[model samples]
Target: MRRVVITGAGTINALGASVAETLEAMREGRCGIGRLDIRDVDRLTVQIGAQVRDYDEAAHFNRQQIALYDRFTQFALLAADEAIAQSGLTFEGPLAARAGVVMGTSGGGLNTQDENYRAVYEDGKNRVHPFVVPKLMNNAATSHVSMQHNLKGPSFTVATACASSNHAMGQAFQMIRAGMTDVMVTGGTEAMLCFGGVKAWEGLRVMSKDACRPFSATRNGMVQGEGAGMFVFEEYEHARARGAEILAEVAGFAMSSDASDIVMPSKQGASRAIAGAVSDAGIPLESVGYINAHGTGTAANDKTECAAVADVFGHHANDLMISSTKSMHGHLIGGTGAVELLACLMALRDGVVAPTIGYEEPDPECALDVVPNEAREARVDVALSNAFAFGGLNAVLALKRA
Candidate 1:
């Protein structure tokens, strides 16, 4: 099996617009969740989100491109541009045929969908944009990424709710490890902070209006965010041969389904995925120094994930450093795991553990070293990224320092 390594990473989120900026924010334990500025804000019960403030589409795309690309697609393209540029790989000849894209987005072009829905239903419009169908499809970002990068290999989109990014990246890692593809442009994108998007989530009654305080007893609920995180996964030897700057090694990945509930999380299923990832990586549980937890700041999710980790690692669980970056970036839904993976990379590469901000009161149920309210400097060799999504889907990725 070919080893997989991450050669480059890029992101545009509430924290920042690039990997460096995002990491800096993480180090400072900054809170990006704030009052959202979207259309019809007065109508939403939940008015707070980690929106990409001051984003002008005209600055990034021309008139035609702006018309064709939804906000999610635009974010994906920008992140991909940064990732591919940092990777320093030109997709041509054999490489072009071997490289591909796999993007994860639950609500592809949701902003577009929201706009068109309002037009036809509320505004009583007869016609909509010609590109509405293409823009709103779940695979739009993946298709556009493939076309832009000239990748002729396998390309698809995954939509397992919050676990979408982790599942998509896990598939990309498996493809490369099985020697089926030499490289893959894999990540996730989401821009669902629009009026319709927030209104829909408001029905779930799980959204926090002010802040997301994961693992804290004072936690209310998750705050939605919009962003994208992109990475270049390359064969280990291919990257080494070209003298590429390796970011981290994709050691192992595992995914599982609860088969138990749709809206609630299952500890057994999450433990299976977490344990499976470590076993697949051939690393002992003690070797894992940090975990980027899927702590959604919800009553059900926070305690469930903590119990799962406790069940998987036993006594070692108490010793491990675990933090939820969602406290800082809000929950990006389908694009979350990709952004959270950046926290793992920072831990392994820079020995900096991101904090779970907004943590005021600690819950005994989630009694672990959450590194609450402040970043910590600790040497970490291996880290795990956890993504437990709606419908009982759980995905975990093990990453090692390069």
Candidate 2:
């Protein structure tokens, strides 16, 4: 089997626009969750979100491109541009044919769908835009990325709720490992911060009114976030031959289904995924020093995730540092695993653990070392990023320092 390593990474989240800026925010334990600046805010009970503040669509896309691209596709392209540029790679010749793109998004072109639906139903409009179908499809982001970068091999999209990105990335890793592709442009994107987006989630009653305090006893619920995280996963030999700057190695990836609950997380399922990733990586459980948890700041998720980690790592769970960046960036849903993976990269690349911000009082159920409220400096050799989605889907990725 071939080895896969991350050659480049880029993201645009509530925290920052680039990997460097996001890492700095994590280092300072900054909180990006706040009152959202989206349309129809007055109609929803959950008014706050980790939105991409001060974003100017005109600045990123031309008029014709804007008409064709939705907010989610625009985000994916922007992040992909950054990742490809940072990798110093140009997909040309055979490389272009051998590379591929895979992105995860739960609601593609949600903003477009919401606007068109409201135009006909609420505003009594007769016609909607012609590009709606192309913009709103679940595979839109992946298609756009593939076109932009000239990737022609094994391109697709994943929509497994919160685990979408992890599953997408896991497939990309497997493709490279099996020698199907030498490189893959993969990650996740989300732009579901529109009126219809938050309104739909409000009915579920799992949103926090103000802050997203993960692992805290006073936690309320998850907060929505918007953006994209993109990476260049290259075969280890390919990256080394090109003299690319290796960020971290994609050690292993594993996925599992609970088959138990729809909304609630299952400890057994999560544990199996965690253990599967560790075993797939061929690393000892003791070597994993950090975990970017799927800590959604909810009572059930936090408690269940902690228990799963404990079950998987045994006594080493206490010694490992665990934190939920959702406390800082809110939940990006399908795109979350990709964004949270940035925290794992930070640990392996910079020896810094991103803290679980907004944490206040500790809960006995979540008694692990959360690295609460403050970033800590530590030499982390291995780390894991966990993502458990709404419908009992779980995915875990293991990483090692380069």
Candidate 3:
């Protein structure tokens, strides 16, 4: 079988603008959740979120392009710049033809759509902006990254709610394994931190009032966040030939669907996905040293995820170093998987397991060791990232130290 390795990682989250800053915040158990500050929201019930405070669209693009692209694309383009720089794999050689891009997004251009509706309906404007269609398209992230890097092979976007990023990375892994592509930049981005987006999520009635407290019995629900995570995946030999810094290997990936409910997730879906990933990885359950859980800090998510992990690994659950970076960065929804995958790669490469902050007390249902409050030094070889979204979608990815 072919081996795929990560050459670079980049992420911009509520905690930080880059991976190093974000990793440091996670190590210190920093909490990004706070009172919403994007706009005046005193009238809203769910008033807190993980907003990236300093992302200036004006700095990222010219006024013309800004009018053409949404805030979500802006985030993705910024993240891709960092990822491409870190990869050192510019379109210089044969690697160009062998490279691709896959990005995931949940609420692509939703903020723009809301504004357009308000302009036409509420404000009674007759005409919309010329870039409305392009800005509102879901594939803008992938296209933007591909165009920037000049990648022409197998470029696309994946949208499966929060599972979008996981699916994107998993598919990239498969493409490289199948010899269809040699290198791929894969991840997710979301910028739904707008008034319209927040109200849309509030309709779900699953957001926390205070803070996102994953694995805590008193946890109200998940918190919304916006950011982008990017990774460069290359064939092992190809990366070595080009002298790229190999961070981790894509060991395996698995995806499953609940086929049950659109809103409520199922433990069975998570359990099967984990088991299938273990099987596909061709590794024993005992070999998974760490798990970056989908601990969304919601009642339904934390409980079912704990059960699924326990069922898949049995007694190993107590020993495995598990955590949810969401505690510090909030939930990125569709972009969560990509950021979580970065956490896993960092865990495997640096041997520093990040903490699950905001875990004041443990929930009985979530009895697993959540590596709470402080980062720990642990020798880990294999790590797993789990991302479960609405519509019964679930995706899991495994990474091994390269």
Model 2 regions lying over 4 Å from their true place:
none
lDDT of 3 by residue, 375-395 (tens): 999989899999888998999
| TM per prediction | 0.99, 0.99, 0.97
lDDT of 2 at 361: 98
Candidate that would win on lDDT: 1
State the lDDT at 289 in candidate 3: 89
How far is 63's C-alpha from truth in model 2 (Å)? 0.6
For candidate 3, the TM-score is 0.97
Clashing pairs for model 2 are: none
Question: In model 1, how large is the Cα lDDT of residue 356?
Answer: 94
Each candidate's lDDT (Cα)? 0.94, 0.93, 0.88
Q: After superposition, how far is residue 229 of candidate 3 from its true place, in Å?
A: 0.3
lDDT of 1 by residue, 29-133 (tens): 998888989899999999999998888999999998888899999989989989999999989999998999988888999999999999999999999989999
**Which whole-number lDDT from 0 to 100 does residue 134 have in model 3?**
88
In angstroms, how far off is 48's CA in candidate 3?
0.8
Q: How many backbone clashes does candidate 3 have?
A: 0
